[model samples]
Target: MKKICLIASLITVFALSSASVNAQYYFFDGDYYENPVLYEAGVSVNAMNSLTDLGGKKGIGEKFLKDLNLGYTSISGGIFFSVSYKNAVALRLEGTFGKVSSDDKILAGINDAAKNRFNRNLNFRSNISEVAALVEIHPMYIFVDWPAKETTPPRTSPYLLAGVGYFSFNPQTKIGNRTIDLQPLSTEGQGFAEYPNRPIYKLNQLNIPMGAGVKYELSPLVNLRAEVVYRKLFTDYLDDLSTTYIDPALFDKYLTPQKAANAKILYDRQIVKVAGINGKRGTEKNNDAYFTANLKISVIIGRERIRR
Candidate 1:
């Protein structure tokens, strides 16, 4: 009976020791997921470009990045606040301010395929202000090897994001020394009784933003990131040129005399105007889009909790 009690006590001691060791192991090396909430704030500098009807690379205008013109790249900036879970997924609210412009004259004398665009003589610049809510997923974070506590989340992570955004733009063009707002001119006879099929587009619209990026931890509290986000827009009028040219006389019937005069010259800037109604002003098949490449710096905020 004494021997039995001694053996049982040894077993109890061994079990207790194993449990204690496991708790310590998890506390020191495997508690990365303990935090339910994490906060971060950041700012970014961006290079902006637009895929519109105005300017493009030589050849017939292509779709997406193939038609990008480097000369028109502009600068933009943004700020963001985010909340993350287990370092694997994040929800972010971001605001961006920027300018985008393009000029078809860039394609002048490039090729026969680009002649029509060069002769079109359309150009525009617009200020962009956007607010977006996005979800970012870090796939690599879930596969972390967790070799040690200090290296659990790794120093670098690649992420993809998709979100909806609200943006406003006012397309403007320079005529001589004067800047003209294109939307108010009803350039394509929009909202005019003569062109019942064409409706005026809103200056503010919703867009879908999707992109990928990579982040590197510069320190425990700071991170550096680079990303390219493409905004898919639903309107072709972002550059103030879409559909066929309206007869100049139509402007007189619908607009004030001063506006009518301005519209006549701004709507058709070509040296040799294409006669009649079928002259294509801009391609209507695809909507316009813009993209930005950003370099960002972020700081982690809020207290971190260590699991017990």
Candidate 2:
């Protein structure tokens, strides 16, 4: 009877110890499944170019100042914040503001000529600002366990992102010492007798931004990322500088003798009656597109399970 009682007591102690060990291990292992959140910020650069023609005479403008070449490539830096869940999905919001301007030589000659014609240069310099939002998906670790190897520490998984963006831009050009005074292509004939002095351009535009990028974990609480994106805009007058010849009859009506003296301005401003200023000429189309590259570092703000 004594031996049996001793055996029963030993069995109960062994079972209790085993239960305690199991509970401790379960708590340690199950913590990561709770899901963690992350946040990030970064900067980007734009490699931009404009595809358009010198409305007047192509070679003439090329020899002097390239009208079609009036566009910009600039470094635009901005802050981007994201909220990530499960380490596999995130929502990112970003706002960027920068000045993009073309080289002055691009329209120097045209500006000089416009000054001579209208008593003030009709040529101008342009600038723009941008903003965007996106949804990201992490694929590498969606189903895989972290701290991948027993000897390795846990790290962030890789991901992909795609989304749309909206932008509001104010396009303005500088003419002489005064900016935004003369309308682009607004005047008719040798002088500014017929055209309006207000700036010529559609001031605002909505654009579509879409692209993809990758992210990698640098540490338990830090990450590195890079991405490339493209923006497709709705308007063609980003440069706000184009020219067409004045009609001979209209020239006679609008221009004084001094304004009509320069025939080149009239020739350049002349457009087919069917295709008015800013009108589509034949198969030609006007739309603008640009590419951007970005680099960012993210810091994990929420709970991250530490594996031992």
lDDT against the true structure, per candidate, is 0.81, 0.47
Residue 298 in model 1: lDDT: 92
Candidate 2, TM-score vs. the true structure? 0.54
Backbone clashes for every candidate come to 0, 9
TM for every model, in the order presented, reads 0.86, 0.54
Instruction: Tell me, by lDDT, which candidate is best.
Output: 1
How does candidate 2 score on lDDT? Answer: 0.47
Model 2 ranges with Cα > 4 A deviation: 1-34, 41-71, 103-125, 141-160, 181-202, 241-286, 305-308
Q: What's the lDDT for residue 232 in model 1? A: 95
What's the lDDT for residue 29 in model 1?
Answer: 24
Question: Which one is best on TM-score?
Answer: 1
